[model samples]
Target: MATRFLIEGRVQGVGYRNWLQEEARRRGLRGTVRNLSDGRVEAVIIGSYEETDAMLAACRKGPPLAKVSGIGLDPIDDPDVSGFIVLRDY
Candidate 1:
């Protein structure tokens, strides 16, 4: 399964992408994470339902520097990536 997460609040410039990369990879998920122009962080995660849900929970809290106010989630087609990565800003 695959999912997209739009993470809001103090996400940019706070190592959110890198943090997500670590979290996703650690959970054996494959996909990408990037910064959005509108001050949010976007992550595309591909994994089992359990892994994806775990990642979402982690994202809600985010890194210590991130003050995540919320996260918007949507189901998406899997990108078929091999490993988790952090993408450049959009």
Candidate 2:
């Protein structure tokens, strides 16, 4: 299973997606992170419960450049996602 996260606040242009991808990969998590049209960053991380929880915690603080205001999470149905990547903005 995957968890989709919508991160709000000062996300764009701050290397948020790149930071997220690096973190996910470092934790052996599989997923993709992208910038949303609404100026938020969105990520779908597929990994174990523990890894997922840790990723969410890091997202709250984001990169040193980001001022994360909020992060909303939703359980996803995808179970085949592989590798971490920084995707183009939506």
Candidate 3:
């Protein structure tokens, strides 16, 4: 399964992208994460049901410096991603 996550609040410049890459890799998931121009963090994640669910849970807290205020989830059919990447800001 694949999904997109829009993480808001204190996410930018907080190591959230690196944290996401590490978390997804640790969970054996594939995806990409980037800092959005609107000061949010966007992540495209692909994995099994359990892993994706776990990933969402982890994203809620993010890295130590991140103060996640909210998260928006959007289910998608794109699964072309591989490994986990911390993409350049978008």
Q: Stretches of candidate 2 above 4 Å error? A: none
lDDT, candidate 2, 12-71, per-residue tens: 999898899888898999988899899999999998898899999999998999999999
Model 1 C-alpha lDDT per residue in residues 1-90, reported as the tens digit of each score? 989999999999888898889888778889999998999989999988988888889999999999999999999987878898888889
Provide the overall lDDT of each model, using Cα atoms, as 2-decimal numbers. 0.90, 0.90, 0.90
Please estimate how well model 2 matches the true structure, expressed as its whole-model Cα lDDT. 0.90
Instruction: Tell me the TM-score of each prediction against the true structure.
Output: 0.96, 0.95, 0.95
- Better model by lDDT, 2 or 3? 2
Cα RMSD (Å) between model 2 and the true structure?
A: 1.0
The segments of candidate 1 whose C-alpha lies over 4 angstroms from its true place after superposition are: none
lDDT of 3 by residue, 1-90 (tens): 899999999998778888888889988999888988999999999988888898999999989999999999999997687699888886
Name the weakest run of 10 consecutive residues (lDDT summed) in model 3. 78-87
Counting clashing residue pairs in each candidate, in order, gives: 0, 0, 0
Candidate that scores best on lDDT: 2
